[model samples]
Target: MKLENMVRKVYPNLMPYVCQLADLPIEEMKQALGKEQVYKLSFNENPLGPSPKAVKAMQEALLQLNLYPSSTGDALLARIGDKEGVEAKNVILSNGADEMIILVAQTFLEPEDEVIIPEVSFVQYLASTHMMGAKPVFSPMKEDLGVDLDAIIERITPATKTVFLCNPNNPTGTVIPADELRAFLKRVPENVLVVIDEAYHEYADDPEYLSSVEFVKTYKNVFVIRTFSKIYSLAAARIGYGIGQEELIEAIHHVRPPFNVNSIAQAGALASLDDEQHVSESRRINQFGRKLLAELFDELGMKYLKSATNFVCVDTGRDSGYMFDQLAKHGVIVRNLAGYGMTTSLRVSIGQPEEMQAFAAAMREILEKEEK
Candidate 1:
């Protein structure tokens, strides 16, 4: 007679996503720590905030709130096509990159299929695979914490349906180089799909880092997913899209939800794409912040990874869970990477100049006290 019991029987062993342990809301953190303000450097959000152009567009679009959004997101599609030089038919917009990941799993995965992902990569890859009752094959990362193309290729088998590659991978911001990817893609089985998740593409400045958008034109099995949430500062808007060959895109759209991208999100995303000035400014700020954080970490005698995205992974040489609490008390909130199997490191998002300074001060105070 219990609904919970019945639901559990029907959907047994559903693996829930383990999201990054983000900071509490600023006001909430202030209350908890008895601080005036708390510097939040947890989720890799843009420190500059959303684009002014996108904000204005969303404001104006509110007048038409009563109407439903364009289910297919044609305007946003055209903008993406123009920017990426792909046709509208090749793009499938979603609520965010999150939906894109789920859509791919739903559209392609069979109960007996397998999805190959980096061992410590995005949690959604495993969660989505489990959601579809597919097997998740985790390929271990390389020494530098980048995707091990060789290991992933070795894991491919007859049951491998898709491979999820999070370029400028979350938690650890390392990227797969263009040459390495080209070689790996060549070796991948033709039947298996390769998904390139570029949620933080705009922040990637490495000369060797390549966008997988071009691969879509050459490979039928290649799908490139992008989100406006990062550098565009449209995280709350939840607008993202997947780009692939026309046939693949058409198939995914068949499984997509109606009006998945709401009106405000579509309007904001479209405006964000056109605001190149804002993009440049965001990149500038991110680059500056990244450099500043790296320098600070070096000065603190901490080990950290060189990041391609708008966040730095720092090793605090102490229990990261304890470190995180101490940081909170010092009015700084950063992501504890223990969930990512990293107990001594924290993933800190690149914040504004003042926020970074505050983080540096707090980190110094805690670490120095620990040393004493």
Candidate 2:
């Protein structure tokens, strides 16, 4: 008669996705630190904020809040199709890229199926796989913390249903080269699905980096996921989408919830497409901030990954938990990697120049105090 017995068998064994360390609200953190200003660089948000056009569109769309939005985000799909050079039929909209990950698992994963996941990539991929009662096969990353495409290909078995690839992967911020990924795709069995999570796609400027959207055009099994949360500064709106072959998208529609994306989010995302200037400026500032952070890490004699995304992962040569607490006390909040089994590393998001300078000063002060 216990409610716990009614829950799915997989629910008890699954681990929650932990993306942040500090539990306190910003106001509470400020009060505790006794600081006038706190720089939250824990989340990889667009430092420039949301686009003006998107904000204006969301404001105008507010008048129609009483009505439900397009059940499938038809207009936004059309615009995304135009941008990605795919037909409207090739895309599926979701509450966020996170939900799309879940929907894909719901549609394709059988209880016994196995999903190949990079060892240190986004935690949601593992969470989603477990939700469907699927076996998750962890593929170890290379020594440099880059996705090991070759190793993943070798791990494929007949039971493998899907392979999750996070391009310019979260935390590590490393990307698999286009040639290597193409080669990997060719070797993968057409029957197995490849879910490419490209949440940080716009931030990657490396010439070798190729969006999996190109693969989606030719490979019926390749599904590319993207979001407005990262570059469009619409993290709060929670709008994300997936691109794949028309048939693949059609299959996923069976599990999609009605009116999943709200009206204001749709309007903002639609208008964000036209705001090329804002996108460009955001990318520019990210590039500048990344370079500055890399230089600072170099000067500090810390080992850090060469990032292709908006955040950089650096080894602190001390307990990451301690580093996180000290930095938080100094009004600089960064991501602690303890949840990911990385005890001596932290992931710092790219912020504005002034914010980055604040982080730099905080680091120097902390290291000096430790030396003393």
Candidate 3:
């Protein structure tokens, strides 16, 4: 009897994550192209880098490398609770927002249950649902590229266990209006969980946009998932948190592993919270970069979606894969949306001022050559 033949029949072989072309390692691309300078604008990472306070804290935390991290991550939870106006008991921190997504699936989903997500949104929602053998229902976005709350609401059935909404949605960078969200929440069944993934929360300053944390207080089934990876520039630290009712959070805790969030991440996240100046500066850079990119696109006569997040999705009027390769040769990297079914579109992250300028110059050269 072969060991491979003895595997569980119901378990499906999972496919490896297929990343966007722009997300491939810059160093590898640089080596291939023989280019020295690489501008990474594919991951929506903070251009200014990590908070100074966070860097200092992580460096000092090296002294405790021999010791185990705090299992509860209580101090960081307290800071998050204070900032989000939620009780520490109602918050669950994870290695990253990605971990939180898996935790929710492990806690709430069962075989045959339905999980709703936007068609062009985060890939994790589908991956988590598949991991649990749950059915994933993709609701298509509206004409303007925003989440169609009405479509999502109409698709909900008793089998629907979770609905993941990415505010200032990824790839597209469009947001669901506060009024629309409030209306949608009211229509959601109490048993169905509503997950609001606000990974780019710090970048969104639109007057009509509402933070989902406020709903965690009023609704038992709502969870607001946030991360330090964005504005805090703590992507490498892998720290994020989810806010929900105390009972909901307790259920997730039951499935959480001990010391799931490391001490260094906890230290970095806590210190980053206190660094308001850094947060403000990151926001300023993102806002300026977004504006600059938009203007560049306008000058080039390229069509682009107005962005509320650090990235903008633009129609390049050519095959994105070819364009991605072209940009890589020029030492400029950006996200190719071919995997998202937008073959002619590319998602570009706002970088430092000089890097954005470089991207603009590279893009102009690429487009001009295509014309000739």
Each prediction's TM-score versus the true structure: 0.96, 0.97, 0.96
Using TM-score as the measure, what is the rank order of every candidate, best first?
A: 2, 3, 1
Sequence-dependent TM-score of model 1: 0.96
Give the alpha carbon lDDT tens digit for every residue of 207-243 in model 3.
8799999998999999999999999999988999999
Clashes of each: 0, 0, 0
**How well is each residue in 1-372 modelled by candidate 1, as lDDT tens digits?**
776766633166575544332545667767777879778888788989998999999999999999998989898888889989999999999988999999999899998998999987888888888888898898998877878999999999999999999998897998889999999999998899999999989988888799999888999999999999999998888988999999899889889998899999999998888899999999999999999999998998899988999999888888999999888888788988888788899999999999999998988888779779
Please provide, for model 2 over 117-188, each residue's C-alpha lDDT reduced to its tens digit, 9 standing for 90 to 100.
999999889889999999999999998889999999989999999999999899899989999999999999
Q: Give me the runs in candidate 2 sitting further than 4 Å from their true place.
A: 15-25, 31-35
Consecutive 10-residue window with the lowest summed lDDT within model 1: 15-24
Taken over the whole model, the C-alpha lDDT of each candidate is 0.89, 0.92, 0.90
| Alpha-carbon deviation at 327 in model 2, angstroms | 0.3
Span of 10 residues, lowest total lDDT, candidate 3: 7-16
* lDDT of the structure predicted as candidate 1: 0.89
- Which of candidates 1 and 2 reaches a greater TM-score? 2
Which TM-score value belongs to model 3?
0.96
